[model samples]
Target: MKLFFLNVLAILLRYTNASASFQSRCLAFSPESTIFNSTLTAREYVTKGTNLTFPDNDKSCNQPFQVAAANLCRIALHVPTSNRSSITMELWLPEQWESGRVLAAGNGGIDGCIAYDDLAYGTEHGFATVAANNGHNGTSGKAFLNNPDVIIDYAYRSLHTSILQAKKLASLFYGQKYQKSYYIGCSLGGRQGIGAADRYPDDFDGIVAGSPASDFNHLYAWRASFYPITGKNTSADFINAAKWVVIHDEVLRQCDTLDGVKDGIIEDPSLCHFRPEALLCQSGQNTSQCLSSAQVEILNRIYNSPLYGTDGKLIYPAMQPGNELKASTGLYNGLAWPLSQDWYRYVLLNDSTWDASTFNISTAMLADQINPSNIRTFPTTLAPFASVGGKLITFHGGQDQQITSFQGARFYNNLARGMSVSSASLDEFYRFFRISGMFHCGSGPGAWVFGQAGAASAAGIPFEAENNVLAAIVDWVEKGKAPEGILGTKFVDDTVAKGVSFQRRHCRYPFRNTYVSGDAKEPGNWQCRGV
Candidate 1:
């Protein structure tokens, strides 16, 4: 008994001393450790109870940074490039709450602003989080003018270098190596995460990407051509929100029960072939409930995959059905998308005041030649990433009109073919989830809430356990448990009706959620099986 107690006391003392050393060493990042041959612009040791405040003018999330005074070590790094543009990275270390892991996230849009909300969420969850400004520090594409170096950083280097530094800093601060590293992001941020995995294969063990803008140059070019091709001025002209609701109702009527349930969601949109021509108005029979021939043509164009006529090459993937309303309102509202404009002006044209209306196939062909986003954003080869035991999980909203959910499927299919692996084997490393009735990220008519960073929430579906993307990825990395299906909830919010309406489990790719035999409304009634 005495010997056992002595052994336990020795172990406790060792841990206590190690904890003390970790705190002291973390607080000393400003003075010690190798800089990885980079310059440190600033370092601050935030004590375990400090409140972080944002500028009043910064209305990003409309909430000032306020957390339970966490013990943190913050560091700012600058990596210089040939064109005199520098990559600025911020690393936040959790001193008091060490999760023995590093979580590196990325930015949205062409905006180089660090994602504060994502960083806060990571730190609060006991992760050492880091976010970069994607090379420049502004919300516009003006920074990319005549700056090829900054463009390269934005395309890839910013995340790669920042993650390298973050991991190093984590090891230096904790005096122990992180058990695993993960990347979490959405939209442009999602592209960054995949870019990191492609360029820097060993950076993360697991990654969760949502609505990724993978084909960077073509995506923007496609959006730039939307208004011209649609020949409509606003979403109201193309398909009003009310009209979309009508179309959605019709879609549900036709395909909602194909999954053996009429829950107002087309579970597998791939299985749905809802025809818009059926909604066409007959000659001499004009009605608000039906679309005109022109409207039907435009809808078909919007839903079909775009192909470049110049070389007969595919540009964008086919858009998922049922997102017509949101796409009409948010993405394809006839007006030029600002991000598309930014891509043409800064990255492609080098003219700050270039007219976007003149954007055409010729300009796109030229942009494709100088496509730096190709090697970084859309790496055709991901074997290096998979070789490092890295896992990628991406979720796309079926109702996401902005980027479309079909991009995920196209990318995965290509990835599997490129890697020479079967779909089942590909599922071992990469998995894609298609969320029904979910808009860009979340929030739509169906059970659209899955707890992801910048994701929508449903009532009673808190960001916990397997319901959360980050949590699911963490479990996959730490426990070698790959997620079979993710649970989604429909609840009352400002956008959705009140109360816990239903819970649906969205199965991973290759394995679909099928209704067997039971109460169709209950999640237990469904099982994940091969189609």
Candidate 2:
């Protein structure tokens, strides 16, 4: 009885001491006192802690609310430079359940809010997480107006600075260096991950990029060209929300079964040769379910014509075929996408109030001269990062409405051709996967869960080992066992805890998940076969 009491007392004492140490260290966290030379902006312990809800006060961009975290210390820093804009960073450190790892997440759009949701997601998984506003304070392109320094910071400098300072903070707080570092991002965040590999090769051991917005200048230019051909009043204009559903159905009907399966997802989008003209109204049989001749032409222009540079070089690949429904309502319809519009207005013209209607492909091409985000994220050279034992895995949704999967495909092809390296050689340090029916980052009708943290767990994969993309990357980096394929789960009710409706083992690029004589809906029934 006496020994038991003594052991309990010792455990209590250790817990108390650790708690006390955390509180004391939290108080001593001063950004200016850090090893890095930077002016401290804000230092405070978030007593309420981390939660996913966007705060009411700062609801401008649906910013994630930091409300229920325990022992959370929020540190902000500003590293000034010769330019007008400075590098600003936010580091979120966990007081308890420290994973001894660091995960740096990235931002979206032109918004300057630190990715609070990603930070919270990382902390929940016991990782010390950090994010930046890409060097601005709000979700507005107005910040980029005539500020070259700000643009430079937004391009790649801010994330690099954030990662460096965050690692320093992690070392200081834990009293031991982090064992591994990883990055998770989609869209703009995806672009930033690739940028890190290029500029700061040794920064992270592994990177997870989804739907990367690479080839910045050309992407915007190509996206803008669609407006001239499909604007509301243009001669070739043909898409509307109602008409798009008809086309969406047609695409699936034509190609959804090419993988020897009858599920909704088009497993091999590359093999699906869907023709839009098939849906064109017959003669004068105009109906809401059918597209007119003008509309067919517009769809063809958007999906078949590759944007070319002034020198006749291919600039951007054509948009994919099956995403017409999403494009018609969310991103591109009969007009320009707002992100593409803002790139030309603020980043290029330096005019926030510039009329988007006045913009055209020619003007967008001119804007490339001032492309501040000219970071070669998809460069031919991976020797620097690869030599140091870095691993990178990227995935793109086949139906991504914002940044097309073709963009990723183009980069991979370019890298292979540019370096004269075989695809197998590139797979040593890099792998790209394509999710069949997903949209931009997440959401859609596909088995969209890949165990990526910082978002809702929808993949019904029960095991922790199979569900987290960050964990998978960490295993690859530390254990050196590269992933052949990642399991994807679709929840019955689109949730993680709910029963899995179906699952698919998404094969890495250059391979297709072929159905081989079994239940079509079952993941085990498919084989990852080469194209």
Candidate 3:
């Protein structure tokens, strides 16, 4: 009885000490101190705390998100990288930070929108979180026009500088040095994550990049190539959303059972030789449920690797077979994707009037030569990052509609060849997981939610190393427990409140989750087998 009482007292004392420490630290936090030529523009200390519903007052950025955090110190900084442009960042310091870790989240697309949701996400996890508006502001990349400095900031400068500044600020606030640092990003954020690993190898100890748009010069080219094929929504070659559903069903019918399960996931897209011709319309067939002959040609171009020039050189990896459902929207919505439009016009050619119709196979080659703001990240060896003992976990959704899922494999294969190390050896430092049925970063027919950035963090999901890729990476960096498979959860109706519907332990690269026995929905029934 006495021992129990004493233990309770000790717990109380510890809690009191932590509370007072946070109080003092919060009070002493100064916004005046700046690093990397950054100006401390705003500071906010929240007492009400946040529950993913905090009202935002910062009007500096046109499309600022309503911050989803509470009980933290928020600091905003603006860094003028060059005479023509600048970068903006927001740093959050939480009271419950016991891990002594720093976190940086990447931005999506070419948007200079600060990852406010990510900042909130990291803060709740007890991390001193920071997110930068990848140079410029708002969701548009038009600012890249006539601003090479802005492009430079977007390409690499913003994230690197924001990280350094955030770390220094956290040290000042806590009066101690951080133990480790991490990065989480998808798409363009994933691109930035790769760039950080390549250029500033010492910045992050662990990086979790999902659907990384890494092969920048070619990625832009790949995205632009689609506009010419699909033309407009009214074009004869165009396919509607309803017919796309029919196509998705056809793809599943052909490929779903390849992994010995009819679970709607194409575990390995490579295993399936997708036949778009199989989806062709028969005479007197329901036109709405089938493709026209020209539409079949469009599907052929999409399913097969994109080719350019008279000699037919492959431009980029083919679109994954299973993403047809998601392919009906976003990048494939029969219009010029703004990011591609802006990149070709502003960043590459510096001609706003440069028609996207003129964009072709040679455009990709031209982009390679110009390489605006030096944003092309592919073909660079990750030797420096690997040498520094940096643990990297990159993932691409198998049903990804934005960027082709094959790029991650291409990157990993090259990494091993360049380093002259077998994949078994590379497993010690870096691993790439291919999440089945996941579209872009998250959400799809399969077990898509794996506790990544943004939505996953705010979804009220448990932050276990098994289900969370970020937690899994931290486990690798801090505890030396390398992940062979990341357990993914498919929430019922994509919401935690609805409860979990199913789960899958998504395998690391060179391996696909093979069915052993029992129910297909059961995660244990699947094993990571070599591809």
TM-score of each: 0.86, 0.92, 0.93
Candidate achieving the largest TM-score: 3
Report the C-alpha displacement of residue 523, candidate 3, in angstroms. 0.9
| Model 3, CA-based lDDT | 0.82
Q: Which of the two candidates, 1 or 2, achieves a greater TM-score against the reference? A: 2
Give the per-residue Cα lDDT of candidate 1 at 387. 84
Question: Tens digits of per-residue lDDT for model 2 on 1-531?
Answer: 999999999999998787777777877877577745688776666544434343432355676455534556777677764447776677878776455789899878766777776777677666788887787777767777777778878888888888888888888777898878889888888988988988889999999887888887877777777666777634444566877888889989998888777777888677877788898788677578888777787777777777777767777888876677777775556566677777778888777676666766577667566667675365877778889999998898888887778887788877778778888999999988888888888877788887654655322444343555777787788888788887777777686666777878888888888889878678888898877
lDDT of 3 by residue, 72-133 (tens): 87778777778777777788888777578999999888888787778877887888999988
Question: What is the Cα-based TM-score of model 1?
Answer: 0.86
lDDT of each: 0.74, 0.76, 0.82
Candidate 2: Cα lDDT at 30: 72
Candidate 3 lDDT trough over 10 residues, lowest sum: 48-57
Cα lDDT tens digits for candidate 1, 1-531: 999999999999997786677667765666224654567766766655566665632353344564533566777776665447777677877655556889988788887877766766677667888888788876778778887788888888788877777887787676788778889888897888788788788989999888888877777777787766665564444666677777777777878888887776777888887688888888777577889777787777776546474787877766677776677676566667788888888877788888777777777777667885563277667888888899888888877778867788888877877788888887777888877778877677666667567423422454565677788888877777888888887775534446667777888876778889888657888888887
State how far residue 258 of model 3 sits from its true place (Å): 1.6
How well does candidate 3 score on lDDT at residue 15?
Answer: 78
Model 3 clash pairs are 50-70
Clashing residue pairs found in predicted model 1:
49-69, 50-69
